[model samples]
Target: MDARGWDERYGQTELVWSSGPNATVAEQVSGLKPGTALDLGAGEGRNALWLAEQGWTVTAVDFSRVAMEKALAAADRRGIALEAVVADVTTYEPDRSYDLVLLAYLQLTWDQLGPVLRTAAAAVAPGGTFLLVSHDLTNLAEGVGGPQDPAVLQTPEQVAGALGGLRVETAERISRPVEKDGETRHAIDTLVRAAAP
Candidate 1:
C-alpha cells in the first residue's frame, strides 16, 4: 500500500495491529544484548517501543505520517525515547548501521523486496542481526489469516537468498496461531535471522 492509503487507514483505526512486540521477535531477541536497533515498516512502533523498554536505542521508520505520530504519542505516554522517521521503505537509507535491523510484515513483490532486504541486511553492524518475519507464501492455501494475494507473501528461501553477506542462522517456516470466528487457526510465516560477520 502507498503512504496515503496507510495514513488513511491508520487515521481511522486506534490500533490496527497489536500493541506489543511480535511474539517470535521477542523470543528471538530475548538472549541478545541491547544495542542500536532499526524497525522498518514499523506501523505503530510496537517492536521499536518494546526494544526501547529493553534498553536498546531504537529508530522506527514508516511511510505513514499518521502512524509515525501515533508511535510518537505512545512513546511520550510511556516516557520512552524513540527516533521515528517518515520515509519510504523501498528507498530509505539508514544514516548508520545498527546492531539489530528488523523488518516485520513488509510485503512486496520480489522485484521491490530484494533490494530493500539487501539494503537492510547491509545496514547490520558487525556481529549484529537482521531479522525478518513475514506471512509465508503457503499461508494462502494451508493457513488462516493473512493477505490473500500471492504477490506480497514471501517464502523462506526467497528471504534467505536476499541476505547477501550475512550467515543465515535460521531460515524456515514457523506456525502462528490466529483467532478467526472465535476459533484459533494457524498461519504460516517465514522467519529469517542472519548475522553479520
Candidate 2:
C-alpha cells in the first residue's frame, strides 16, 4: 500500500495498531542507553511515546495526519513531547541523525521496501542502532497472523542481507500470540537489531 491508501485506512479507524510498542522491539532495545530515536512508519506513536518516556528524544514519522494527531495526543497525555511528522516514509528524510532507528512491522514488497529501509538505515548516527521487526516468511507455514501477501514477508537472512555496514546485534525468529476469531495463534516474526558500522 502507498501513502494515500494508508492515510485513508488510518482516517477510517480509531486505532489500527496496538497502543504499545512491539514486544520484540521493547525487549531488544530496553537495555540500550536512551538517546535520540526515530520511529519510521510510527502509527499512533505508541513506540515513539514509549521511547520518549524512557528518556529518548523521539521523532515519530507516518504518512497519515490522523495518526500523527492521535500520536501527539497520546504523547501529551503522558507528559512527553514527541515530535511527529506526516510524510511518506519511503521518501522522508531526517534533518539530523538519530541514536536509534526503529522499523516495526513495515509490510512492504521487496522492491518497494529495500530502498526505503536502506535510506532510513543510513540516517542512523554513528554508534547508534537500527532495529527492524517484521512477520517472517516462514510464518506462512510455521506460524500465523500478518499479511497473507508473501511479497511483504521476509526471512531473517533476507533482512540482514538488505542492511549494509551495520553490526548484527540480534537476528532471530521470535513468536507472538495472534488473536483471530476468538482464538489465539502463534506468529513467527523476524527480529533484527544492528548497530551502524
Candidate 3:
C-alpha cells in the first residue's frame, strides 16, 4: 500500500498493531547490548519504544504521518524518547550509521525491496547488525495471518541476496504460532540478521 493508504488505515483505528514489539524482535534483540537503532517502517513504534527502554537511541521511520504521530504519542506516554521520521524507506537516506538497523515486516515488491534493503545495509556501521523479519513467501499456503499478496512476500534467500556486503548471521525460515479467532495456527516467517564486516 502507498503512504496515503497506510495513513488512512491508521486513521480508521486507534491502533493498527499491538502495542508490544514483534516476537522475533524481542527474542533477537533482548540479549544484545543497547546501541543506536533505526526502525524502518516503524508502524506504531512498539519496537522503537522497546529499544529506547532498553537504553538504545532509536530513530523510528515510517511513511505514514498518522502512524508517526501515534508512535510519538506512545513514546511520550511511556516516558521515553524516540526520533520519528516520516518518509518512504525506498527514498529516505540515513544521515549516519547505526549500531543496529531493523526492518520488521516492511514488505514491498522486489523492485522496491532491493533498494530499501541496500539502503538499510549501508546504514549499518561496522560490526553492527541489520535484522529483518518478514512474512515468508510460503506463508501464503501455510500461514494464517499477514498480507496475502505474493508480490510483497519474500524469502530468506531473497533478503540475503539483497544484503550483498553484509555477513549473514542468520537466514532461515521459521514457524511461529499465531492466535487468530480463538484458534492457534502456525505462520511461516523469514528471519535474516546480517552483520557489517
Candidate 4:
C-alpha cells in the first residue's frame, strides 16, 4: 500500500497494532547495549519507543503522516522523546551512521526492497547490528496473518541476497503464534541480523 493508503488505515484514534514492541525485536535487541538507532518504516513507532525507554537514542522514519503523528503522541504520553521523520523509506538517505539500524515488516517487492535494504545496511556503523524482520513468502501456505501477495513477502535468502557486504549473523524463517477467534495460528517471518565491520 502507498502512503496515502496507510494514512487512511491509521486515521482512527485507537492504536491499530499492539502498543509494545514486536516480540522478535525485543528478543534480538534486548541483548545489545543501547546506542544510536534508526527505525525504518516504523509504523506507530512501537519498537522505536521501546528502544528509547531502554536508553537508546532513536529516530523513527515512516511515510504516513498519521502513523507518525500517532507515534509521536504515544511518545508524549509515555514521556519519551524520539526523532520522527516522515519520508519514503524506500529512498530515504540517512545523514549519519547508526549503532543499530532496524527494518521491521517493511514489505515491498525486490525492485523496491533490494536498494532499501542495501542502503540501510550501509548506514550501520562498525560493530553495529542491522536487523530486519518481515512476513515470509511461505506464510501463505504454512502460516497465517501476513500479506497474501507473494510479491511483497520475503525470505531469508531474499533478504541476505540484498545485503552483500554485511556479515549476516542470523538468517532464517521464524514462526510466531497469534490468537485469532480464540484459535492459535502461526505466522512465518524472515529474520536477518547482520553486523557491519
Candidate 5:
C-alpha cells in the first residue's frame, strides 16, 4: 500500500493494530536491557512505547499522521517519551544508527521492501541486532490475521535473501493461531534475527 492508503486506514477512529508489542517481539527481546531502538513502520508505536518504558531511547516512524498522533498520546499516557516521525519507512533515513532496529509485520512487495530492508539493516549499530517479522508467504494458504495479498507476504528465505551481509542468528517460519468469527484459524510468520557484522 502507498502512503495515502495507509493514511486513510489510520484516519479511522480505532487503531488497526493492537496497542501491545508483537508476541514474537516481546518473547525474543524482552530479556535484553533497553538501549537506542528504532521501530520502522511503527503504526501507533505500541512496540516503540514499550521499548521506551523499558528504558530505550525510541524512534518510531510511520507514514500516517493519525497513527503518529495516537502513538504520541499513548506514550504521554504512559509517562514515556517517544519520538514520532511522519515519514514513509520505504524512504526514511535515520540520522544515526540504533542498538536495536525492529521491522515487525511490515508486509511489502519485493519492489518496495528490498531497498528499505537494506537501509534498515545498515542503520543498525555495529554489534547491534536487526529483527524482522512478517506474514509468511505460506500464510496465504496456512495462516490467519494478515493481508490476503500474495505479493506482499514474504518467506524466511526471501527475508534472508534481501538482508545480506548480516549473520543470521535465526530465520524460520512460525505458526500462530487466532480466533476469527468464532473459528480458529492458523497463520504462519517469517521471523529473522540478525547481528550487524
Candidate 6:
C-alpha cells in the first residue's frame, strides 16, 4: 500500500498496530547501550517511542502524515521526545549516521526492498547495528498474521544480502505465536541484525 492507502487505514482505527514495540526489537536492543537511532517506516512510533524511553535519541520516519501525527501525540503523552519526519523510505536520505537503524515489518518485494535496505544500512555508523524484521516468505503457508502477498514477504537471507558491507550478526526465520478467538497459532518472521564495520 502507498502512503494514502496507509493513511486511510490508519484513519479508520485508533491504532493500526500494537502500542508496544515489536518483541524482536525489544529483545535485540536490550543488550545495546542507548545511542542515536533511526526508525524507518515507523508506524505509530511504537518502537521509536520505546527506544526513546530507553534513552536513545530517535528519529522516526514514515510516509504517512496521519501516522506521524498519531506518533507525535503518543510521544507527547509519554513525555518522550523524538524527531518525527514524514518521508518515503525509498527517497529519504539521512543527514547523519546513527548507532541503530531499525526497520520493522517494512515489507516489499525483493527488488523494491534492496535499495531501501541499502539506504538504511548506509545510515548506520561504524560499529552500529541495522535491525530488520519482516514477514517471512513462508509466512503464507506457515503463519497466522501479516501480509499475505508473497511479493512483499522476504527471507532473512534476502534482507541480510542487501546490507552491502554490514557484518551479519543474526539472520534467521523465527516463529511467533499469535492468539485469535482464544486459539493460538504461529507466524513466520524473518529477523536480521547486522553491524557496520
- Output the number of the TM-score-best candidate: 1
lDDT of 1 by residue, 65-96 (tens): 99999999999999999999999989999999
In every candidate, how many clashes are there? 0, 0, 0, 0, 2, 0
User: For each candidate, what TM-score against the reference?
Assistant: 0.99, 0.93, 0.98, 0.98, 0.95, 0.98
Count of backbone collisions within predicted model 5: 2
Q: State the local distance difference test value for candidate 2.
A: 0.87
- Tens-digit lDDT string for candidate 2 (1-197): 66667778877877888888877888888999999999998888878988998999999998878889999988888899899999888778899999999999888789878887788778889999999999999898889778888999988888888788788878889889888889998999999888986
Report the C-alpha displacement of residue 111, candidate 1, in angstroms.
0.9
Descending-lDDT candidate ranking: 1, 4, 3, 6, 5, 2
| lDDT of candidates 1 onward, in order | 0.95, 0.87, 0.94, 0.94, 0.88, 0.93
CA RMSD, predictions in order: 0.6, 1.5, 0.8, 0.8, 1.3, 0.8
Off by over 4 Å in 4: none
Residue range with the least summed lDDT across 10 consecutive positions in model 1: 104-113
Q: lDDT per residue, candidate 5, 24-86, as tens digits? A: 988877876688999999998878988898899999999888889989999999999999999
Q: How far off is residue 92 in model 3, in Å?
A: 0.6
Better of 1 and 4 by lDDT: 1
Q: Give me the overall lDDT of model 1.
A: 0.95
Better of 4 and 5 by lDDT: 4
User: Lowest-scoring 10 consecutive residues by lDDT in candidate 6?
Assistant: 106-115
Q: In terms of lDDT, which candidate is strongest?
A: 1
Candidate 3 per-residue lDDT, tens place, 5-55, comes to 999999998898988888899999987889999999999888999999999
Task: Show where candidate 5 strays beyond 4 Å.
Answer: none
Candidate 6: misplaced stretches above 4 Å?
A: none
